[model samples]
Target: METFTEWRTWERARADLAARSLGPDDLVVLDRAVDAALRWHGDQRRPTGAPYAEHLFEALEVMVRGAGVTDLDTLVAVLLHDVVEDTDATVSDVEAEFGPDAAELVDWVTKPPAGGQGRQAKRVAKTAYLRRLREAPPDAIRVKLADRVSNVQTLDRMPPDFQRRYYLETVTYVMPLIELLGDDTGGWFSGWYTSWRRRFGHLG
Candidate 1:
């Protein structure tokens, strides 16, 4: 649990991007995506109280470092994945700025609105999202798998009840989606899921 500094996330993400050796054009696109996400998620915090951008960077890191993703559009989509869900940014805005493919990836990963309701509504929303992902493109599922990895990687920082429910959701909803990916990406997520389950499964 280190301090939530925006620079740290950029520093880490840049290092991973550099390792991939993206071309000049792709580098500029990734930078723009990062800038847009930072601007839109301004001053937002995660459940663990880290700056919201940290989660985005962590998700990208999981894809690059763990899953060996180097696709330019997928990486760009990773950067802007949450803007539509958490900020005022709309799907049309993402599509207009980042192009249809990247926007489509974000749209696939973004959960439907849960509204102001209890856990049941949120669970129903997530369940529906998972069903939709069953037929989503492999690349879209890759982003989602990486997102879940980043989320569950730090379960200790969350409350015991949250840990329990999230672990269940990951097993029930996410694992099946990972199966749909049918690539080594699913292996990466499964590794994380198994480790976290052993550590947190009893909390339920």
Candidate 2:
């Protein structure tokens, strides 16, 4: 089994991404966004007990390096994608630091407003969020696809019941968004989804 040290290597593997040819301003913004994310998510851990920043970094690496996305706004948004959801940060904070485009992409990818909604209502809200991604800028959806790929890769490490629900949710609420990302990302999503379904489809 991979230890935490081994898992942590994923962060270091992004050195190649950091070394990629980027414009001066783009590199500056990427560094600033990464620094901010590290500060905001300080010592935070995921439910799987991994450092939360690892997930964010992995998503950014995939979107920027793997997907060949060099847009500064999209890259910055990828870094701050979970800030509003997991930290005390606000969309305004991201906008003030990064730009309106970054803030808007983050907002577009964020889960919908949750009120006194029941389970079904929450599911409906989630579905709505996925559908909204269809119209979202391709950059935002690309980051979301990277996030989903990371989550799906680790689903087995979660509780069995939770894993089952996540699988169903991915197929129902998330797959369509992947489908909408179009060809380049669609291929990645399909390959991951197919592998996941082979392993867990029996649960559904």
Candidate 3:
């Protein structure tokens, strides 16, 4: 696998985005969205020890450039996909800045467990989150699918037990949600899901 600093994954994403012919407006909006997300998630890092912005950018690139999604709302949602989860950013802040659709999409995708939850409670909360994701807006689902696809591809970089848990969660929780997106997004998600299933289906 490529080292994190090599960033081969991001390089491929950049190539795809370049080929997508994103308009000047698209570029402007995406730049603003990235800047906002960075300000919100300043200096945060994921468990995998990578800058959180990398994951956000990957999700946005997958949806906007890889899935051929041109809708402004979906693109914005992709860029801000993890803000509510990883930062102090509020849904109202997103709404006031990016409008209702983008904020709603981000809110739908954010999964917050019930306060003071234990293991079973967290599991129940997760189940409920997935259920709500089913009823969420299509743009939210699109951002979610893109996020899951990126996560699955990087699963190997995590610890063995975490990988197992994440794999099972992807199959059980995320795969169904992927089916709820628009045609183009569902197709992109299916491609990633099929590859993940083929490579890791035998694991617990």
Candidate 4:
């Protein structure tokens, strides 16, 4: 059964947002973000072959429902976070459409290009990104945590090696980042990751 807390689909996400305390203007902004994400992602799919929008929705839902975030700009950034990294969209494009706060938040969470080829270089870039993420604004950190949660929550669908790599990265960097917060969102993620580790620790 689909619950208010689980929103991997637009229909569930929209319904959950409607039940929240957003004003009309907030809804408009979020709607534009959704439209932009879908349009820009255009047929993109996850490694498990789910529509890319599903990941976006899951992140946004984690922010709103799981983390109790309701700020319009933060939520908008959650929806559009991957747009700059994975699509032709740029930070300027995000800023022009969503304003500078959302732009900065999205840029803070977006992974920089790898400096060299192959897995080693990509690993370096990813490591650098996670370390840099430690200094991002609290909202950006939340966005990244929510993004990682959505990404790693379903690792079994991918190869075991990928699962192991992601688990180490999450524990080494992302989980520590959450620990530093010591806030409500941090508590939520602590519980979630602990349970997740119990289920997937063997793979790691």
C-alpha TM-score for every candidate: 0.89, 0.84, 0.87, 0.94
User: Candidate 3 has what TM-score?
Assistant: 0.87
- lDDT per residue for candidate 1 within 72-131, as digits (tens), equals 889888888888988999999998988999999999888889865998888788788887
Each model's C-alpha lDDT? 0.80, 0.75, 0.76, 0.86
- Residue 189's lDDT within candidate 3 is 69
2 or 3, greater by lDDT? 3
lDDT of 4: 0.86
TM-score, ranked from best to worst: 4, 1, 3, 2
Which runs of model 3 end up more than 4 angstroms from their true locations? 1-19
Model 4 lDDT tens row, 100-137: 99999999999999999998999899899999988988
Worst 10 residues of 3 by lDDT: 1-10
Candidate 1 error regions (>4 Å): 1-7, 115-119
What would the TM-score be for candidate 2 when compared with the true structure?
0.84
The local lDDT score (0 to 100) that residue 27 gets in candidate 1 is 79
The candidate scoring highest on lDDT is 4
Model 4 per-residue lDDT at 185: 81
- Look at candidate 1 and give me any clashing residue pairs: none
